[model samples]
Structures are given as structure tokens and as C-alpha cells.
Target: MTLLAAVAVGLAVAFVSLGAYVTVRQQMYRNLDDSLKDRAVQAANNGVLTNYYNLQRISSDALGLSDIRVGVYLDSGQKVNAKLSPLPPMNATELAVARGTAPDGYSIETVGTPNSPHFRVVAVPARFCPREDDQACDDGETLQAALVVAQSLKPIDRTLHNLGIVLWAIGLLGVIGAALAGNAIAQSGLRPLARLTAAAESIARTEDLRPIPVTGSDEITRLAVAFNAMLAALARSQDRQRRLVGDAGHELRTPLTSIRTNLDLLAQADKRGGLRAEDRQQLLDDVRAQMDELTTLIGDLTELARDTPQVRDAELIELSNVVEDALLKVRRRASGVEWDVQLSPFPVWGDERLLGRAVTNLLDNAAKYSVPDDTAGHRTDGEPLGRVTVRLLDGVLTVTDSGPGIAEADLPHVFERFYRSSEARSRPGSGLGLAIVKHAAEQHGGMIYARNAPNAGAQFTLWLPHAATQSR
Candidate 1:
């Protein structure tokens, strides 16, 4: 903006100076031409063309001009008086004017020797007839002659040179003033941007995402408002990240501690020349269980921490098949739990493996919370619950268990990473299973929610848009 303003100012100054210079120069030349015309008129009225001696006597005194010359020419293109030649010889144009053929009456021409100064000249046709009371004569060929007048142009040139110097000085000053004004305007206009930059830099240095103050109704103000909104979002994301890291550390400690304890116990047993085979086998089983729990926790953390799950390869998947696959995998691990599954055509667009994992998580969660039923297939005072109902209709899949339902107070946070209610604290989990399920659902343009069943335990419902209608 500053540079553009400077160029505009310079152009304006140039145009104005050019116009003024032209007007002043033209007026000066007009005045000089008028003076030369007046002198030529006077010399013609004095009958300088009728007598050769009268033309020779014409000098600076005849007209109030310092550098002037006068001459007379006949129609035959012959000078009337050679002694009156203070200027250059008449050229073809002057000869034509004398013979009444050229159009120009006044001209600027170089006179005297080639090294001499230039002059302004004029030619007026006249009659050389004898002077009479009435100074009128017929336009006869023999009576035609041209009265020539010349004046030096040095004064006019000097005046115009001085004017040019003054104009250039004024133009230079105008450009300087415009540049200064443009700089001031640009600085004031960019002050808000400078403040915004400083605020961004401060955020970078301090790792703080506090919003900057915004004021005004311009584009810059809108940018500031958007920047503040971004900062607020970043602050929320950072808080979630910090909480996730803290919870992950806390969850890892339990299994890691148990593994270390089991290893230490085995080391002591080895030092005592080995234990009984059954005792050693039990210790090995406990160690293996702890290691498996650690592995599961780490894998859950990895799934929960994935930021760009949708970047994985996507395909049109039969969600019913995914659920059945999950049920088959869980059936191998669940010895006595009964799975009542009713699958139908449920197609969706997503990463098929991730969707399968989500379905598997839901089944595993249901199985983890239930106990195997007794021989009568009924719950006793000491027996835990066992039964799962998996159903799919249209694009919605629901998994329900006969175990205890989630507490109402913990329902809202069920899908939050590393969140577990007090009732679930004793369960062996890293609290990331439901979070991963929620992320997978959202990444596939779907949603998952949990609610207490009408008569029994909790039901988890996942709704995915159908592949035919899902947006890319």
C-alpha cells in the first residue's frame, strides 16, 4: 500500500508539473510572438518595403527590441537591401511567403552564422507601390514584397529554464511529502496486524492458548476473532491430552507392578533351588495373565490415541458380518455365556478392521461384566449374571447384556478416554475400550450411545449411516 501510494503521488505531481510548465512556456512564447508581430506591422506601415535605403536604416531603435533585424524581399525572391542582412539568408519557406504561396506568416528559425543564436521570424506580404493619401493598391505581381522581422529568443528560453527548475523543486518536495504521508498511513493501518503477530508469538513462547482481545469491524477483526476461537479449541484439546496421559500412567502402574512382583517371586524361588512344579506353574500363569493385561492396556491406549483413524483404508463393509465375526471371537473365550445374535443386511462405509474391532470391544465389554450361569441356567445368590443379546436392524446395531447396568451418573462419561465409574474400578481394563468404540463410530460417520435396558442391564446402540447414502 505504501509503495502504491507513493507511485500515485509521483504521477499526480508529474502531470500537474507538466501542465503548468506547458501553460507558462506557451504564454511566454505567445507574448514574444505578439511583440514580433507588432514590430513587423510598424515597419510595414513606415513604408520600409517601398525604398531599399529605408529598409537598411531599420535597426533596434526602430522597435523597442534589443536583438532585432528587418529586411524586405520582392516577388522575384531578391533581397531589396543587402546591407540590412543581420539574420540568415531567407530559406525556401520565406521565398514562398514572398511569392504569396506559403501558409506560415511567423516561424522560429536559426539566423546569422551557424554558431550564432536562434531567432523568431515573421513575414508579411505588402505592395511596393508609391505612397498615397489612400494606402491601398491592387494585388499586382510587380508590387508584391514580404516585410521580414526577426527577434532573439534567448530571453524567453532563460525565463522557461528558471520556471523548469522551480517546477522540478516543487515536484520533488511534493513527492517527499507524499512518501511521508503514505508511510504514516501504512503504519497506522497495520498496527492491528502487528499486535496479532505479537500475540501469536507470545503463545508460542509460553505454550498458552489464551485468546487475544478483539475490537473493530474489519477483516483484521474477523481474523482476530477466528484466531481466538482456534486458541479456545486448542486449549480444550490440550486439556484432554494432559488428562489422557495422566490416566494412562496411572492405569499402567497396576499391571506393571503385578508383573514385577511375580518376577521377583520367581527369582526368590529359583534362589531356593526351585519350587514344586505346581507352584511354579501357578506363578508362571499369574505372570502370563499380568503380561496379557499389560499388552491389552497398551493396545487400548494406542487405539484411543490415534488422531487420524479415518486416514486408514476404507471399504464398503457388511456391518452384520463384522458383528458376527466379533461374536465368534468372543465365543471361543466365553465358556458358558449364551449369545443370542440376530443379524441382517447392514452395510456401512468405513475401515472394516476398525469397525470389527469396535464390535469386538462391545462384545468383550458385555462378556467381562457377566458371570457364567449355573447348571439350571439361572442366577443364584453367589453366581454372577451371564447372557448377551446382539441385534441389528437397518443400520443400527445394539448389544445388550444381563449384567448390572451402568450407574446413571456415569453414563454421560462412558465414552471418555480412561474414564471408569466406581462400580467398574475392580474390573481389569484400561478404560479405553468404549472410547475407541466411540472414535470408530464417529470416524465412520456414525454414533454410539448407551442406555439402561427397559427391564434388565445396559444396552449399547451404534448407528452407522448406510453405505449407499454415506458422504465421502
Candidate 2:
């Protein structure tokens, strides 16, 4: 837009300058011609041509035509005695004027040694030798000679060219000024947008879904009002989601606890009866496994609900220690899994318990899906075993396993709640484990991703910025 405005202003300035230049040039030339004609009429009226020498002297001294040559011709078309000698041959129009037949006006022509342009004014009288007896022309009086006054216009032409240059310079300055003023106008007009952008960034940084201040009574102000209303709606919706997750988790916790307790009591009673011992033990193991899956799902829902900025800000924890602790917990829960813990010092800003839980969920997922059965000799004495590696490096936590890696098509949605691969549906764990990990990463200003490793396994990596350990 600024470019367009500058071009428009420049064109307008050039047009006005061209018009003024042409008008001034025309007017100046016309005034010069008129002045010359008036001088010729005065000379004819005052009888200056009667004394031709005096006419020459006055024309040179008083009219600033010192370089201009004057000529007079008698009615007989013969040159009169004058100041300049040997004048060029008169054209047919000039000869007619000398014979009292041409009109009284000016003519432009080229003359002089270098053949420069010249303007000439010719005056033809009715009678040059008027009889002294009458004030008017006598009956037998003949027409008088014609007087031609010619002047060079090269100097005036040079002045007009210079004046054109000045006008163009002034026009250029006007265009530059117009461009600057346009930029200022555009900036001032868009100030409201800049303010709104700043406010939006502030809200994003603070995670504060608050109303934006109104700037004016214009459309921009109405946009700000709409934005504030949207923020309010989003805040309410998020609050409702968090509350639902918390309530659902709370409602399921008691029932899951009772189910696990009752299953334990049944197992103890069957063991005391000693009837069909192996079958009872197997039933008890299945009930406990189901209860464990429900417990894990409930815990994941509770963690997801609590994964908020406020909860993350309540603690400063080291991720390396959390990874090690989670690895230890996974080894205890799934003793059949082989663990390789590679730790480093990685301080991050997050609740210790939440970070530990997130790491444990990742490991538990790897163990549940990837552990080999006893027939493969990968497990010893009915203990299913597979390799799990946990590492922390450069503010990043990575957990890898020698399990059937997730397919490439399923990688994108693995972190979504309740998403499970088709082959892993029979696994004894809720699919929310990775979802909780993702939420925990985000709440701590981090990100998490899952990918297949190059050598036939799956890897999960979590990244947190170093500034996460700093103060709010």
C-alpha cells in the first residue's frame, strides 16, 4: 500500500509540474510578443521612423534590444536607410507588409549568424508620409513603409528550462514528503492490531485466559471484545473437563479398591481349603491382574486431571533421578523384565511424584507389550523377560525396549488417551499410560514422541527446556 501511494503521489506531482511548465512558457512567450508589438506601434505613432537614425538609437538604448537588428522598408519595397547594413532579403510575407498589404502582428522565425530562433513584430501604417495640411490621410496620400522589430528568445528559453527543473525538484520533494506521511498514517492506523498481538502473546506466556483491554470504539475494539469472550468460553470448558476427569477418577477408586480386596480375600480362602489348588491360584492371579489394570487406569485418569500448570509449578525435580526411580519401580512390579538404567543429571521444573509416575508408565507399557514368553528361553523359570533401557541426557529422557515396535501408522496417535495398537489390546494395562506421559511433559513445558528404533525396537523420548528449572 505504501508503494502504491508513493507512485500515485509521484505521478500527480509530475503532471502538475508539466502543466505549470507549459502554461508559464506559453505565457512568457506571449508577453514578450505583445511587448514587442506595443513598442512597434509606439514607434510608428511618435514618427520615430521619420528620423530613422533616432528610431534606431531609441530601440537599442531604451528597449534592451541592443543585439536585435531593426529594418524599415518604403512602400516601394525598397530598404530604407537604417542603423544595420546589408539586411537579408525579405520573405514574401514581409514584402507584402512593406507594400501595406500584410496584417499587423508578430511572426517567429530563425535568423542571425548562428541561425538562432527569433520573434519579429511588424507594423504597417496606412500612410507613412502624411500630408501636414490634414490630421487624417489625404486623398492622394500613398501607404507608408513597414517597420519590423525582431528579438532573440534563446535567453528566455533557457530561463524557462531552468524553471522547469526547479518545479520538478519541488515536485520530487512533495512526493517524498507524501510517502513519509503515508507511512506514519499506516502505522497509526494499525496500532490497535499491534496491541492485540502483544496482549495475545502475554496471555500465551502466562497461560492466563483473561479478557483483553478494549482499545477504541472501532471495529478493532469489537474484535478485542470477541476475543475476550472466546477466552472466557475456553477457560470454562477446560475447567469442566478437568473437573470431570477428577470426579470420574474419584468415583472409580473406591470400587477398584474393593474389588482388589475381595479378590485377595477369595484367594486366601481358596488356598486354606486346598481344593483344586492350581486352578484356584490361576483364578486368583487373573483377578489380581484385572484389578491391577483397573488401578492403573484410575491412577492415569487422576494424573491427567491433576496435570496442570499449577501442579507442575509446585516442585523442582531432577529428571535423571526420576527415571532411575521409575526403572526401579518397574523392575519390582514386573520382575521378569530386564532393566538397563543409564542416568545423568537433568534438573527440570515439575512435581517429582508426577514425573516419576510418567516414567513408570512408559516402562510399564514397554514391559507389558514386549516381554517374551518362557518358551523362547528369554525368561527364566516362568519369568517373562525383555530388555528395557532408561536414559537421561541433556534435559531429555528416553526409554527404549526390545519389544514389537509400534507400526509407523500408529505412531502419531499413540499419545492420545485410550489409544491402543490392535496387537496390544490383549495386554493387561490401560492405554492411557503414554497419554499421561504426554500430559505430564506438556504441563512441565516439554514434549514427548514415540518412534521405532533402527535395530528392531521402540523408543520414547521426552524433551524439556533447561529454563523449566528456573523460576516462574
Candidate 3:
């Protein structure tokens, strides 16, 4: 495409330049012919033709003309006049002009001894000359004599040849310049498309939806904008799919584990001959707890799968109050563990149920990881007691726990579906808690991060954009 465009532009310029050159050359030739014709007319008007009888007497003394030849022919086709040089035969065109039937223009033809190039000018008399002297001549009256002036055209032809060469040279130079300019323009115009192609290929190979930079307001820039938008949309869709998979696994793990545990207990009871009432009661309680966990996990997963538009359309509420309520619920579940709660006014825009679920997950994570059997400021093994801290401030919710900190290797994977720390494998909680919190944070135009605190525990922070009413 670029090469074709360059060639097209170059040819157009060359054609225009050639046309102008031809026009100028034609005009110059016409002007030269007109000037020569006018000079001939003036010579004829000055009675130079009438003096042809005395041409030998004054031939060397004639001014302006280096050489002149004159011929006077009678209407009867007899030569009536002569000059120093012998006359050449009248060609067909010159004869027609002398007879007053040719158009008014000069004619070039070879004549005379050497047969060199020559120009001829013919003039007709107004009436018969001296056949009868004193009568008024009509417009169509045949002339008795016609004057013919001839000049050598060798010099003018030589000049025109040189001018033609010069004009051709200029035209050639113009064509060369046009080709160079066309090439430069083609390169400049196509560079953006080349970059766009490269960016598209890179995205296709890597599936990385990075934006391509646009540098102009041309059509190519608009194409780049559309390409980047498509990439962004693809990235968002892929992210949503990943979130869905993680949510599904996280939501199913707890129920599956509960069902497996209950089945194992039933198998052991069967191996004992007969099941006791107490054993039956304990099994029933376990089954109920597992069922409840399954129901809660399913509910959380369904909430996560719901589109954010529906959630965002819900009423706004104080995020701090939601955190406080979740902490109270967690305290009831972990009555033996010490609690450190800090609450401040922080509003958010989202469904209160979704927000509350997010807060519940964070609090639940902290409570689950808190020291299990600590009493009187120490564990049964004499280890220091651990505390769960829930903080809400500046539209940020954080939960920290003083227990065995998450391993460095596991910190990054904590929010992944079905991913639990090594110490958490034997714990009685599903791994979906933090994952749910992460999704909830994102749905609210926020993000969540988990890391080991500088002290001796793990910290989870959820940062959300402040609600519109809480802008101040």
C-alpha cells in the first residue's frame, strides 16, 4: 500500500510538472513567432519591398537585416522583382500565401542553393500595380504583384533546441524531487499503522491487554483507542472468570469436608457393633453444623456471582457500623478469645447485605486464626494469649490476629480459592472467607491485601472508595 501510494503521488506530480513545462514552451514559441512576424510586417510597411530594384546598389548598407531576399510576382505568374541572390522555387504553401489564400502565419521550408532552413512572409498588393494607375480597387480585386520576404531560421531553431533541452532537464529534476517527497510522505503516514499492527500481534501472542499509546488525532489514533478499549474489556472478562472459579471452589470445600467427616464418623460408629444415643447426638450436631456451613458458603458464593450493578443499586450505609456488627457476631462465636475493636464513621456505596458479608468474612478469618485455648493471659501450653483486632476507619476495614502468622510463601495465596495456610488445614473453617472479602472489596470499587504484620501476626486490609455523602 505504501509503495503504491508513493508511486501514485510521484506520477501525479511528474505529470503536472510536464504539462506546465509543455505549456510554457508552447507560449515561448508562439511569442517568438509573433515577434518575427511583426518585424517582417514593419519592414514591408517601410517600403523595403519597393526598393528591391536597387537592392544591389544598397544591399551592403541596409540596416537591421543582415541578409534579405525579396520577390515580386505578377498575377500572370511572371517574376517581376529580383534581389542579389537567385530566387528559390515557390513551394505550395508559400505560393498559396503569396496568392492571398493562406492564413496569416509564417511558414518554414527549405529553399534556394544550399537548401538550408528558411522562413517566408508573403504580402499582397491592394490593387494591380501599374497595370492601370488611377482606379479604386475592390476588396476582391486580384493583385498584379505579391511581395515575398524570406529569412534564414537556423539561429532561432538552434535557440529553441537549447531551450527544449533546458526545459527537459528541469522536468526531469522535478520528477526526481517528487519521488523523494512521495517516499517521505508515505513513510510518515504509515508509521502509525505499523505500530498498531505490532501492538495487536503482541497482544495476540501474550494475552496481555496492555494499552497501546496513541500519538495523533488521525484515523490510526482512533483505531488504537478502539483496540485498547477491546483489550481492557477482555482483561475485565478474564478477571471475572477467575473470580468465579475461585468463588466456586472456596464455596464448595467446606461442605465437602463436612460431608466427608460425617461419613467417616458414621463408618466408625458402624464398626463399633451398635451406635449409642450420645454418639448419635454428637453425629447429629456435627451434621447440623456442616449443613449450616454449607448453606452459608453457598449464600456467599451466590452473592459473589451476582452482578455488581444490582449490588451497587442498593442503599448506602455506614461501613463502620457494619464492621462493628460483624465483630459482635464473631465475639459470640469466639467468646473465650480476647477482642480488640476500633470503629469510626466510614460510609460506603453498596448493598448492606454484601457489605455485611464482607465484614463478617474478615472478622471470621481473624477469629478462626486466633489462639484456640488461651485462658488467664496464656494458653494451656503456657503460650501467650492471642487477640483478634477489627478496625474500621477512613473507609478502610482491617482485621489482624495475634496467632501463628501466615507463612511468607502462603501470604500471597491466602485469598485464592481453597488455599489455606499449612497451620489452617486442620482448622474448622473454609478457606473462602478471605476470598469472599476480596471479591466484596472489588465490587465496591476497592481492593483487599493480606500480609504478615511487623509484630507477630497476620493483617488483612480492605480499602474502599469513600461514599459520595462522605466526601467531606
> Which candidate should be chosen as best, given lDDT against the real structure?
1
Top model number, TM-score: 1
Model 2 CA deviation exceeding 4 Å by range:
1-275, 310-313, 373-378, 381-384, 467-469
Model 3, position 71, has a per-residue lDDT of 58
* Model 2, C-alpha of 35: deviation from truth (Å): 49
What is the number of backbone collisions in each predicted candidate, taken in the order shown?
1, 1, 0
The residue pairs found clashing in candidate 1 are 88-112
> What lDDT tens digits, residue by residue, belong to model 2 across residues 63-119?
454545556666677665335433433565666676756654333343444464544
lDDT of each: 0.78, 0.70, 0.67
lDDT per residue as tens, model 3, 290-329: 8887887677666656645334465668888887788778
Q: How are the candidates ranked when ordered by lDDT, highest leading?
A: 1, 2, 3
TM of each candidate vs. truth:
0.62, 0.46, 0.47
Any runs in candidate 3 off by more than 4 Å, and if so which? Answer: 1-274, 307-310, 373-385, 469-472
The list of candidate 1 runs beyond 4 A from truth reads 1-12, 19-137, 142-156, 178-238, 261-286, 303-408, 438-472
Please, what are the lDDT tens digits per residue for candidate 1 over residues 1-472?
Answer: 6677778888998999899999997887788778777777776766644545444454545445446666666777676542434643467666776788876654444455557666777777665653333344455623677777777778777888898899889888877888888899889878999999999999999988989999998888999999999999889888877888899999899988998998998999899898899999999998998899899889888877776646356788898889888889988776457788898998877888889888999998888776532332344564434888899999899999877798999999999898898978776677889998999998988899999999778899999999889755
Question: What C-alpha lDDT, on a 0 to 100 scale, does residue 115 get in candidate 2?
Answer: 64
